[model samples]
Target: MAAPSHGLTAPLSGKLKNVNFRIGFVELGKKKKRVFVKCCSSGFNGSGICIEKCENWKFDSRKINHSYRVKVQASSSTMPFASPKSRFVSKQEQFFPRCTPRNSGPQSHDAPPKRDTGIANEKEWGIDMSNENINESGTNEDGSTWYRKSGEDIGENGYRCRWTKMGGQSHDGASEWKEMWWEKSDWTGYKELGVEKSGRNAEGDSWLETWQEVIHQDEWSNLARIERSAQKQAKSGTENAGWYENWSEKYDAKGWTEKGAHKYGRLNEQSWWEKWGEQYDGRGSVLKWTDKWAESELGTKWGDKWEERFFGGIGSRQGETWHASPSSERWSRTWGEEHFGNGKVHKYGKSTTGESWDMVVDEKTYYEAEPHYGWADVVGDSSQLFSIQPRELPPGVYPNIDFGSSMPPDDEPPPNR
Candidate 1:
């Protein structure tokens, strides 16, 4: 019944670039370099966005197993999809050319990697794998301030640490300073959230991820990703056992922004393909960002995409920050997005930080400014000491005012500050 060509002629080699073709098939990707065409083994059903390649038809020749016929060979990096309802068959390969499962039952090219029910799959992949015990510091107030705790429920959810010492040294010597840890794991109705706590400062700048939110309705919390290795079967030569996420981000308030891709190589012969690294937020800040990589089969040069933009607070705090530096020649894979505007982009999740706000402790106010005398007279009762503190200097500059309120009674003179 071969109908609907609409081009009257010339479909990909040259002319015939638009219109209704009686209505049917046109989705493509990549034009100048070849290989576009969304659904065309002779079927034809396209959409668009494939600026190179593709002149008339090329995406390995087509036919991705409607039920049988599994041809797909740009060399066979792989693209296997079979399902008796799918116990698990969505296994794609990489480097091009390896997918070959014409329905054989139990499903196995080599088999082995797929185990569940282990520490509940290591807390369903949030992975702490359980096992933590840290205890040493004891004394409180009288012993120069100290504390220590372990796991299984310390400061409420688990893990607690507090340390403070002066003259004798403990701030950097390590007496155990400000530390916290939390845990959670529940199943039935489901609840498996994760928390990461980090605070370091013995040297320069220190502070790391204290939050993580997965946009909710949580499909096990997006499986919480971050899987590095261990899970490779096809006999372990490495195929379904590694970490490879290409363009992975499913934005959904229900609007579903859309992001899902997978292109492997080696069964036949393409090479690399990546597109993971996206941190975009709108009203809450973190404007837009992307970290990309390419080299499936086009020319030879690996691709790159490091974008950054922040008109306002990207998630707030210190504001804006999204970097993805990785072009020393692909440098393994590629990653981008740094801090923008600076507020800190929720720091890691949730958002907000003026120390946590809500502190209305009026009346203890004390100001101290000596050198440039740049004005520090909010006063709250140091017994009215102002030798020559008439105020009026802004040269060298030194500012450290702590006004918990209460000390402004120098009799009508606390206005300039």
Candidate 2:
């Protein structure tokens, strides 16, 4: 039996019967070693030898009229054979041949097909700009590219850091890309900004999206503003093919001081839809408003407009909310609740969904209090915020993070540090 170089140990003693043996050479790694004593046990009529369960050693077989018991010994050392009838084959063959190539003839059709990239010989093209403050810029073997950089500076009061990365891929005439940039400064008046963008383009279809945020904190006030927008279009390769959509939003530190608008359509078919909405939270009051309309590709249409506001706490508030659909379905609600200085309350509405009767509320229901929104809801603590420090991997060393691209080109091993 043929065993792995590492698995071959002291001589292996086994039994065989009615067998004829020959010596052959099997290629192992970069060298060929002689194979002796080929036989199978337990009646497996294969051309290969087997000791116990091993069946990878190959040899020629012939019918012998006389049956006789024979001992087989496999070892790491070679054995010499001097029998006049003994035959030795020197052809270097694989110990365990798993496949035979089908296209081994001289004719082109019989030859293996060549791997085809779009270009006949698309040589790699890229540039390296790695330095103290920046690192990693190049193209990958699969025609994808990426750039990344990071830096930090310690100031008198605190520190500031920034990071940016952009990557893209091209394949089968389609392209996809993304980028992110972020900065944070905790020195004196704290400030931070971040932006992200991504998009993809394929034959007759494309989409793009972006998000940005800015935050400022000082002794007097803490403020933040975040915005997001996206657009998508497909002209010729999808059901209801001519499609389009765009939306933008703005959010502030105030709990509900957020506003946004969205629009979509099958523009080529003249069908369109839009929505606008806003929210407010402050001065012991909260309000929400929305107005939207839509015309579908099938000529169906609908519209909805509503607003709800609450002030003076719990049961003492006023607002109205209503909606109407193309099916003539209607819903409406209105409220006008007031709280008296003596703890008494009065409530009224034109068409209310819940009970309109007023009752004596809790003593602090109408107390003066300002709503506070914490930055932790959107950002993080110092430890979490500064956890992503700049890294300097040696050239040819790739980090485990996803680069939105294929594997980078192979490079020579970096010198030992």
Candidate 3:
């Protein structure tokens, strides 16, 4: 039939520019089946290879399609020659397979609708539609809208929506919306279309609600004054009360005086000198003076007879006796005598009282008199020999004086007599 469709019999070969032209076949119900060759490629227009040059050729029935059907089968050894046919087309004539079908089955109701991916379309996707008044009616370059509600003219530059009063009232009057920019014009008036404005005031008013009216200057000033007055009154009440007094009293109480003679006397006195008056003989007394009369009087007041006592007008005690010198006498002396060689007049001088006045010498003249023979000088020297050159005496002259042996030897004569 139709020459058994010789198209299946030829083993296509050439440069094999497209693998779609290559194909293969297998016979049914036979072990030793025949081989058929047709457009030997995997897809239309030779998209892939059907048989590789180095691989063992095997008939694969699964790849067979209606367009490349098998008729007569040929053995692998039969290298059939192909004749020219008009089926081949140029490379540009090929068409790619379509990926998506025009119509899919009914879409599930749960599937979300596709949304526009562009940034401009995002506002339509459930964005907040509530109007917002930024300053006054103004449009950004991108067509975004802004508006304002209260206050003065929207500042300058890009500052759009602001407020102003009908009259030139300074921060205190009815307010109307005003638009502002670097340059002013009559087109500044516009409508405020938005939700309530939100922000905080300088005085800490939060923006939870819209401001119905501008804050009055007098109200603000009065509130400031009330706050300042409250603060000042609180400060003065605490500071001017008895707080400092109690503090000072407690602090000063550390030196509080107790009731006693010593305490009262100390308080009444101005200094240590005044505390004891002139009673104390210690150096701390104020009445102390270098004048001789005052010191003498002071000594007398203390039961001292110093004026008639020591040569320097000071008194002293010896044992139980209080010895004193007369006021006119600077020094006083006692007299005594001793005799040797049977108390004969030749041996010692006899006093008018006959009490053996060998010699009566006081401490001052003992050395000048040069008395001898049992005459005991006050300072114990029988050789009461005063000398103008006193330093030339022998070493023992002062220590070894014969106070007991009070007579010259009969064999000795008076010195230089």
Candidate 4:
């Protein structure tokens, strides 16, 4: 449970107990330290892994004496399908880890940004960004966790970690080898549920002081929501309009700080997914809102915002709030969501290419993309011109729409944000 030495708290901690069953996601929300979550299981083989509970405590700057308060989201069946008699529950669909960062923050800037410009920044917490093949691995001598510090760049290393455990006494549990940018690699040994004593032991190694075995779950239970600090009220309670110039991963001009759900079939009789976030621009006039749902049957809303970094990148500090490049780029890309002041509500933003988008809040329309098609554009909605859904945008969309050439460079792929 050693945390990163910055403002960010540990977003997640998962150890790959079974290779076929990886922890899907663990993340901190947009409203600073107030909101966070850690989901488990890859759903690869119908295996059920979950974070039945959540609790947190703060260590003094000196890193001593953390007071933890664990809340069980569901007492029974919280970590279901790990029972000794558990059977393989398979479906045609596969559930990936639910740990994708959305860049939906506050919106600012009286004018839109130049979306045509390009940038890139990858969120692979613990892998070599430069040399995907060259990785630096480390194990928690005392615990069940292991880490791979990226050798690709100067400041890339273990920022976040995820874990999972096998269930049932019929077997000695399971172990696995992990290897995903945000995923754990290689299982060393087997363990049950509940990982206690996450703190480092003498000689400096985190130990899983204790683990709880899975109690068979006959019926699904609701994942109890862990209460947290107060959140900032911005953009109808959204973080902010999260899009910025280039919104790309390659141009991480500012060292910034930092998922989805599924497989939780009808926890309490509903199977649906919801995600919402916001972002702002430099002038504090632009804004973006996103309200997306997966199954669409349930009417509950999910909350999160776009981020500069992530769970491990949480505490990263910003040296410059705004930095403009020689090209058409705005340094405000790393600013916080509340940095903008546009008081508009725009929903259903489509990631034109999974990064930039077109928005309309309070009759003002905004668009962001690379220079190829005019980065930022703004116009009063007096004509009700932007009333169409993003899907309805004209085929050429914004005109001169580049179909993208021979695939973007390896480093410049469209972002999940």
Give the count of colliding residue pairs in each prediction: 80, 0, 28, 82
Clashes of 3: 28
Listed in order, each prediction's TM-score against the native is 0.21, 0.38, 0.10, 0.20
Best lDDT among the predictions, by candidate number: 2
True-structure Cα RMSD, model 3: 60.8
Ranking by lDDT: 2, 1, 4, 3
lDDT tens string, model 4, 1-417? 344233544444544332122211122233212223343333222111221222232221211254333333433344433344433221100111221122211111001112222211111111121223332333222222333323221111211123322211101112222222221211111111122222211112111222122111111121111100111110111221212111211111111101111111122323333332222222222222333222222343332334331121121111112223435343232213211224443333322234433443453322431211111211121111122111223344232322365334678744311
Q: Candidate 1 versus the native: TM-score? A: 0.21
- Candidate 2, residues 1-417, lDDT tens digits: the string is 454353332333443222233333333433333343443322111111221323334333232463223333433123212222322211000111111122211100000111111111101101111124654555544444445554555543344556554444443436545444455554333444444444444433444333333343312233444333444333443344454444444334554344455555564444655555544444455554555555654555555555545565543455555554557566666656566645555656665346455445434344433323222344432232233333343476443433345333468432110
lDDT of residue 383 for candidate 4: 13
The local distance difference test score of model 4 is 0.23
Which portions of model 1 miss their true places by more than 4 Å?
1-242, 246-269, 273-286, 295-299, 304-417
Model 3 lDDT-worst window of ten = 225-234
State the lDDT of candidate 1 residue by residue for 1-417, as single tens digits.
344333322243322222111111232332211223332111111111111222222343333452213234433222122233322222211100112122211101111223211111122222221244544443222233334344453232222222111111133342212323333322211222233322222222122222211222323223222211121112223232222222233333322132233433233334444333323232222223333443333344444444444433231112222222334322222222333433222222111222222222223212111211101211111111111122233466443332546356668653211
Candidate 4 wrongly placed segments (more than 4 Å): 1-175, 180-268, 277-279, 292-417
Task: Write candidate 3's Cα lDDT for 203-310 as tens digits.
Answer: 222211111111111221121000000000001111221100000000001111111011010111111111110111112111211111111222221111111111
The C-alpha stretches of model 2 lying farther than 4 A from their native spots are 1-132, 135-139, 145-161, 171-173, 184-190, 201-204, 218-283, 297-300, 313-376, 379-417
Q: What is the lDDT of residue 34 in candidate 1?
A: 23
lDDT of each: 0.26, 0.39, 0.21, 0.23
TM match of model 2 to true structure: 0.38
